[model samples]
Target chain A: MNFPSKLIEDAVTEISRLPGIGKKTALRLALHLLKQNGAVTEALALALTRMREEINYCKTCHNISDHEECSICQSHRRDRSLVCVVEDIRDVLAIENTNQYQGLYHVLGGVISPIQGIGPEELKIESLLSRITEGEIREVILALSATMEGDTTSFYLSKRLKDSKVKVSTIARGIPVGGELEFTDEVTLGRSILTRINYSQD
Target chain B: MNFPSKLIEDAVTEISRLPGIGKKTALRLALHLLKQNGAVTEALALALTRMREEINYCKTCHNISDHEECSICQSHRRDRSLVCVVEDIRDVLAIENTNQYQGLYHVLGGVISPIQGIGPEELKIESLLSRITEGEIREVILALSATMEGDTTSFYLSKRLKDSKVKVSTIARGIPVGGELEFTDEVTLGRSILTRINYSQD
Candidate 1:
């Protein structure tokens, strides 16, 4: 069947691009947006506009931020000597929600997946090395997922930092198979974090 | 503890207002939009802006349109004699996907909901009656859900249209209990359309 109009079709196409959103969901979301008052729609548009105009990755921690340095990296209360390395900004948020970790973060952008054309160069591993070289980092927590790529990245990082005095560690992988840090319940993630172990022994 | 920033928090709050979107999901989507290049985010913003700036309810059928009348109403191939009444614009898209029906549509916006304060006056029932007064219309298909509100609206409409010579019908109740028409597979929705029943004795 034909679309009601090109604009409607375009909206469907745009909304479908969102993660986990399929064609039918996109159509519903588009129609829902269509029904809203101009102010609400404009608010979404303004948010999107602001995201484009203002957001940038913090040079220090690599978290999404509106400034040159993310709030997490700029905060004085955070322990700079304890850096948590994660795969993406989502992991940063997950860690922040725990409220128990007082350490700073270093986002790797993604795990090393050679099959998917993602290698060490594609990630921010170089930046991480420089940050640790500053000599203040006494501990580096690998908070990457429990996937194969996550394990490989942890092993690679542990090997690379072997000569350094920095104590490289990893969060426990007891969250069950196929579990994602993003979807894991907060309590479970918290427990896993509390039960962290040294990665060098593995 | 506090949101990354006030602007980020505000944007996430707004996104969370959407159906099925939680705080974490909202934050993820907001961050995703922020991470994209300016042009991609601008396109997303433009989609929202244009949807707000251009879309309005079709004066005749109450369906969302970029103009005074929707494309279906403007099309010459569609049967003006047959008007398919639906709960919302999403229903219109569902029917369109099947490529079966070639008639105009009337969006009621919602069904009769006593608790939600929705009634005949709240919807575009009077507008549907106004369209039928032209005498060219021969049939009216009630394509609403099988909820209590849907049943009430259908029964109310059948009674109201009994005096008119126009034929009244309802889409078959092939949809499962508590199931939304939006989630019903296209095949099931198509079968329901093929098995529609006459609501009036005539």
Candidate 2:
């Protein structure tokens, strides 16, 4: 589409470069910005630029942070020996929001995906191994998704930690808490049955 | 949703302020940016800031431009005696894309919407009238949308220009090209029948 101004064209071009945004959506967003107060654009541009330029990652867990180590990694109350391995910072935030896990996190940044040219080497696998070898970790829980990439990454990590004393495990997969069994996929149903837990006596 | 870092939180907050974007989508976009080369973020931020800070409006038609007068307003190829009144620059671009009309445009920025507290004084209606009064324009085509606000603006403009010598006309309303008559709404169908054009003869 033709733009009336060079500045608008440039802005739309840059905005539409994002993963999900298209040229039409970018144009709509640019026009929306043009209608708003100048302060809105100023804040948006400043936040994006500052985030990209000055953002930090936790040295230990590889999660995004404003300091050398993330708040989760630095907290003394967190169980240092129990590391919940995740695919990215979003996973860390999701688990944290639940307030159910007391352990620290090891963010792999991404899982192994051959089609995307991303392998274990491109992730924070080396740092995870080093952290495990340091000998404080007792259990390493792989909380990655159930996709092929997640399974491949989990398998590789388990094999690598086989020599170490740390007990490597994966998060349980089954129907969601509110999910009906009839609606559950066959693979998940079969797995849930095979790994069924016995009823605990009160 | 929670964010792992302050930088990520700030960026998500700012990005989500756009019309349709929500916090989750904003976080996804922010993380996508973090995974890309730093140059991408820099370019996006620079483009948005520069556009917002330096963009200009055409003095004559109020359409967005990089110059004092828009290209359409300054062009000798366009008919100076004909002006299509539109709501915004997007409308101008839409009409230009059609390639059917060969006249200039006058952007009102928005229509008269009392609920939104927008009135005729807030738009470029005064300048439009002055342009007509200049005695050069022979016709004023109302190319606004077919909405309540659009009709209100058109009505107000027609009443104001009743004493002027220039002819005032509105774009035709009818079933869209490729639109099925069965699916056409009652109002549009009725209007199309009432204002039906004669069959062309060789």
Off by over 4 Å in 2: A181-183, A200-202, B200-202
lDDT of 2 by residue, A1-202 (tens): 8888999999999999998999989989999999999999999999999999999999999999999988888899998899999999888888888899999899999999999999778999889889988989999999999998999999999999899999999999989899999999999999999978789936
DockQ of the candidate models in sequence: 0.46, 0.82
Candidate 2: global Cα-lDDT? 0.93
Q: Residue by residue across A40-144, what tens digits does model 1's lDDT show? A: 878877876775676567888887776888888888998889999998877877788878899999988889999988999989988889888899999999998
- Name the DockQ score for candidate 1: 0.46
Docking tier of model 1: it is acceptable
Please, what is the whole-model Cα lDDT of each candidate in the order they appear? 0.82, 0.93
Off by over 4 Å in 1: A66-68, A175-202, B174-202
- How close is every model to the real structure, measured as TM-score? 0.82, 0.94
Find the candidate with the highest TM-score and give its number: 2
Cα lDDT tens digits for candidate 1, B1-202: 3565566777787788778889888888877776566677678778767766776778888887778888789899999899999998778988988788998899999899989888789888998888899898999998888778898999999998999999998876666778899999897788778877679959
Residue A14, model 2: Cα distance from true site in angstroms: 0.4
Number of the top DockQ candidate: 2
